[model samples]
Target: MTGSPEAQTSQTAEKLPLPIRLIDGLSGLSAALAAAGLVLLALNVFLDVLGRTFLHRAIPGTIDMTINWWMPMLALLAFGYTEKMQDHIKVTVLLDSLPIGLRRAIEGVFSLLAAVLLMFLAYYTWVDAARSAKIGETTSSSPPVMIWPFKFVAVAGVIVLSLQLLATAWRNFSGRLPREIDFDVDEAAL
Candidate 1:
């Protein structure tokens, strides 16, 4: 993303190990799906409003669909991509006062710890998802809508998030992770 196509192909980024590349791809996929879901969710709500206003009839399952399907798809899948982009909110005033080496070390350790904790979370969520799948979990709309698939989406999100965290931990420990660039935008300029 930082360079032209030819530059990137010739750069060290493309040489990252296969697992790292795969995790990056997974994160990208999650982001893409989340974006697509956002579009669809907006369209769905628009249609629901249009139908009700024009025909005096509401979409039967629109509310359920929004709550069960689109919400989880958007929320759960965003974590890894955000983390990979180093876009998570940070209050670094205290860390900024620390020696660079110690700060990096602390960040690295916490990332590693978080990754481990999320692995356990992913496993537990998978177990619950499997149970939901086995039971054919669904919403109570007039026509039952399967809701279990989105449970797996949550699990995938967690797994990808943890993997990215592990990768971050590695970069942090090795001092290869660049400090995230901060951009100050003037609200009036927009």
Candidate 2:
């Protein structure tokens, strides 16, 4: 019995193995972390407001915790996952007008640039984390929690984003990515 072309393609895709699947899974985790961080931020704000309005006492260190810690984590963690899903905002007026080959070439160049930027970010953040860890850096707020963890999170997120950018570049090089005007659109629209 012979398989259909679609089935053959599906099997070939499946044969690409578990690491890409794991990377995709990690992207999902990053997204979940970002969502959780947002929820936490909102909750902190709500609690602070309640405390200030009704209880006549603001939540101590809430601003420090949410702003200094949660927001950075949220933004960093969301970066790679959002890019992986092609959910990042784009002004595609120019890109959309370009020929497929030219558009892909442009995308490849941009992906390489993004990967380099992310690598630099990861390197600097790792150094910052190391310095903070060595010096035992702590927030100047009431609770005075250690700040190195947040820096480490930033480094991890940047590394993940860098990997995703490299993956995208590889996909583009191999002609795997669809020749679509907008990445968010369905493949049929390409």
Candidate with top lDDT is 1
Each candidate: RMSD: 4.2, 4.9
TM-score of each: 0.85, 0.78
Find the candidate with the highest TM-score and give its number.
1
Clashing pairs in 1: none
Off by over 4 Å in 2: 1-17, 92-94, 178-190
Q: lDDT tens digits, residues 1-190, model 1?
A: 6867567544645666777667777888998999988998999999999999999987878988888889988988988888877888987767766776788788889999999999999999999999999999999778787889889999998998999998778767776553343333336866
Q: Rate the local accuracy (lDDT) of all candidates.
A: 0.83, 0.76
Residue 30's lDDT in candidate 1: 92
Give the distance in Å from residue 99's predicted Cα in candidate 2 to where it truly belongs.
2.2
Clashes of 2: 0
